[model samples]
Each structure stands twice: as structure tokens, then as C-alpha cells.
Target: MPRRLFIPIIFLTMLSACGGTPASSPSEVASPASTESQLEALATTSLLADIAQHVAGERVHIESILPVGADPHSYQYTPQDVAKVADAKLLILFDDTSYETFLEPLLLTAGGDTEFVFAGAGVGKRADLDLGGFDPHLWLDPNNIIRCVENIREGLTHLDPTGAAVFKSNADAYVAELQSLDAWIVEQVNQIPAERRLLVTNHESLGYFAERYGFTIVGSVLESFSSGASPSAQQMAALIDQIKSSGAPAIFLDAGDNPALAQQIADEMGIRVVADLHLESLTDGAPAGTYIDLMKYNVTQIVTALK
Candidate 1:
């Protein structure tokens, strides 16, 4: 139906000739380092870690509690993750709890003093994008990520007030980048004709993307938003019919997601399955490595498949 969808790191080791002892740069000396080491922040999900890193910059190294490329919808928390939660001074999680299967276990084991930041706490979600509950994949829309940056800025400021200015500067720069990414997505999506902008995903997480980018989500392979869910035969038949009728050319599966189900559905319609779409988590260092990269990669693939 109707939809709206919608980084850089530099480390310079400065050298000072003070009896071979290096002095801190003015920028670094200005921001207090006291709290950073004393209060470490960790992002519980892979996507949160990526976005949080952009906002955090050098203020704090945001560790990922969840492994890279893991599906948060069905991720199981390890004992090491519990220890990380216990030690973390602040934990960043997406406000949309429905999308994070690891949240409950993470919280139950978290220290009482551990601060929490909902990265997309203040962003608005479209009513059309609600799948069962609100779509937890808010990061799919670049505009929503603007608000995520803001939330992260504020949360980091709270965590280490001494780094407020640093956080603001990083967040502002990243917000501008996100705006550019949004514009780029619009430009790239234009390659697809409106009639051709139909999406059939492995999960129902693309609602925000479809609404923002003027595409229709024909439906997902899983009727639910979680990849862990299994579709009933009836549900599968309905989705197959929907995709066939909608003329959706391919089934979009997230990178590293099991494509057997989507492959089965696509086989029914004689359509292709577009695997390697990175919507859930970042990859090691290429293609969906960063949030921006993930969006660009997914958009390019979707446009290519649909156009």
C-alpha cells in the first residue's frame, strides 16, 4: 500500500615533544574522559550498535551485545552477553521492544544502575506501517534515523555530560548524512516505475520503507514481522496468491537469512528470490557493514530486482 520510507571515524594519534610524552589535542582535552571509562555503554542489538556508533563517535566505543549479522528477532542471549549487560553502565536498545527478542533476557539480567537509551524513542511511526504492533524496523526509514541520532545524542549527553558538545557535533553531522541518504534513496528508487515498486520481503519489516519510499509491500513470506515465525500453509498460500496477483517479481530475504521458505514461494510463482538484502543487521565490513551501506545495498538490490 502507501508508504513512506525513507559515517566517518578519524583517529589521529597526536605526538607532543614533552620529554617523549604525548599531550592530548585541544578537542580531546576539552571533553572529559573520566566517565567514558568509568561508565561504558553497550548497544544490545547489531543495528543499534551501528547507529549508536555514529552518534557516539569517539565519545564511547559502543559494544554490540548481539553479534553482527545475527537476527535480533530470534537471537538468544549468551552468558557472556549477560555479563556484558551486568557490566554496562548504559545500554542502547530500540524503543520498539517487539522487534528485539533479546531485550527481555538482557533486561532481566541487567544491573539496576544500568541506564537505558531507546535510540528511536521520539521518532514517529506511520499508522500504515504498523504490522501487528508498530514496525520495529524504524531504521529502515532514514527520516526515522534522524530522530534516532537525536535520541542517541541526548542519551550520550546524559551518560557523559562532559561529552555533550562532542556528541552534538557528531550527531549533527550524522543527521545531515542521513538526510542525504534519504534523498539518495528517493533518487535511486525513482529508477523503478511506481507500478513496479512492489516489495515481498522474508519478514514484514519493510513497512516503514514501503510507506516512506512510495512502494507497496505486497506481503512478507512470514505473515509476522519476525523471521523466527513459521507461516501456516494457509498463510503461505495467501501470500503466494498476493505476490502473484501483485506482479511482484522477487522475494526479498535479509542477508544471511534462511531463504528456503522464500525460495519455495518464489518457485510457485516462477519469480526469482533476491537474497542478501541487509535489513536486520550489519555485516562484517562490506556491502551492509554500516547503516548507510546497508540501506544503499538493500535499496539497490530491491530497485534492481523490481525495476
Candidate 2:
């Protein structure tokens, strides 16, 4: 081989040694090992599912029984959902009977060895609402979510002792995030004057939210805790009178509920009606995608509407 041929061969060898491959972008990079191989958990709602995912991290696969915008208070469980629950190794549910009215019977009849972890564990009743029981919207308050995270962490650790450290670390980090979110929410709420911190929601969904924050529950359209119930003519008339006297700026409706009732009330009082606030379930691609995002989105909507 001549000198020119030898030099070309050397260059080809160097190119081959380097593989001549383009580097993978961040999106194209292989993800770390998924915890799908580990125990799978089923959460009753999307909000609870988000909390469980944050606590369990990649150590446990968390699935939500409710769809993106389904009303857990009125959602009927399908046979597929029952199968999902029965196949799960853990079940995370809110302990309120009114909210998750369908979960208890389904769990009992499903006949699975699924370990239970209640998000509303140790959480007491809501003194603000007359729903005949506890408020299941405890996740609205991030502090309550801290308790939920701890309960979920304990359950996950008990299920997989070897993953305790992972669960603890994730829970600690997530709790810190929740604390920061709580402080931010307080600051956001403070922007509105004390007199303007009045809220009128679709139902009793925001009892815990108003209690945690400084808002006053002026009235709800349904007067009941669950969205499945209907408001009587007398209740509607009374709520209209309350809104007219309270001078509340907006009627906040659940993202999943029909806003016709709220619209009717708002039309009567000439007040604004905000229907994008996610209360029970997280949105699929909406601004309120995660638990924290949902809170921030609601806060922004409230502050904007009231301030």
C-alpha cells in the first residue's frame, strides 16, 4: 500500500473506532429502570394518585381508578375498574364515605388482598360544612397532603421494606415542595382584601380549602357535599339571596361539573363564574395537571377573580 492509501485507511479506522454515531437527545435517552416490576398500587382518585406517585417515586407503580375529569362522588365503578383494584398490591383511598361512596363496597366485594392506605387518615370532620360527615377534599390543603404522603410512605415501606429509604427520600422532598406551596398560597390569598375572601363553589368541595385558606364559604349551588345531588328550589333561592347580600365576586364551579347551575346563579347576581378550578380530580392536559399545579391554578383563578 502507498502512503496515500495507508493514510486514508487510518482515517477510516479512526472513524469506525469512534462509532460515528450521533449522541442521543435528552428525550431520546433511555429512562432509568421503572418500578413496574415492583408492587403496583391503585389510587381511588386522580388527586390521590398524584400524591401516591410523588411519595412512591419510581419504587412503586401508581394507578388512578378515576378518569381525568370524572366526578368521584358520582362515578360508577365498571367491571374493569374492579379488576384493576383486585389486581393492585395496594389501594390508596380517601376515608370519607360521602366522597368515595362506591369504593368501600367495591373493595369489600373485589375480594383482593390489597393493602389499604387512607389519605384522610387521622383527618377530622369539616366543621364548616353540614355534609353529615368529613370533607374528602383534604388534599386542597397541602399540610393535609403532608399527612397523606406520610401515610402512603408508611404503606409503601410496609409493602416493600427494602424500598423504605427511597420512599422516605421522595416523601421528604415532596413534603418540602408542599410546604413551599402552602406558603406561596398564603401569600397569594393575602393579596385579596379580607372582605373579598368570599367563595361560592359548585358544592361542598371547597370546605377544606376555605378552612385552610382565609376564604369564607358563602354558599354552594347543591348545598350538599357530593356533586351527584341536586339543589332544591328553596336552596337555590336562598343561595341567590346569600350571594346578592355577600357581594361575592365569583362562583367557582368544579372543572368536571355542569356549570349551568352556577351560570344561573351568576347571571342572577351579575357575578363571574369560574369553572376551570380542579377540585377532586386532576386534569389530563390542563394547567391543573399535578396536585401542586392544580392548587396554583386554582389560586391564580381565585385571586384574579376576587382581587
Best by lDDT: 2
Candidate 2 weakest lDDT stretch, 10 residues:
4-13
Instruction: Give the number of colliding residue pairs in candidate 1.
Output: 8
| Residue-level error in angstroms, candidate 2, position 175 | 0.3
| Candidate 1 residue lDDT tens string, 1-307 | 3222221111112212212222235765567674345446888777778888888887688998878878888888887776676556677777745667677655565433456677767666544333455567888999998887887887788778988998898899999999999999999999999999998888788988988999998998777767777788998889988987899888888877789989987887899998888888888898888999989999999988988
The window of 10 residues in a row where model 1 has the poorest summed lDDT is 6-15
TM-score against native, each model? 0.85, 0.85
lDDT of 2 by residue, 159-261 (tens): 7899999999999999999999999999999999999999999887787788888889998998877787788899999999998888899999877889998
How does each model score on lDDT? 0.77, 0.78
In model 1, what are the clashing residue pairs, if there are any?
A: 3-210, 3-211, 3-212, 4-211, 4-212, 4-213, 5-212, 5-213
Please give the distance, in angstroms, between residue 218's alpha carbon in candidate 1 and its true position after superposition: 0.5
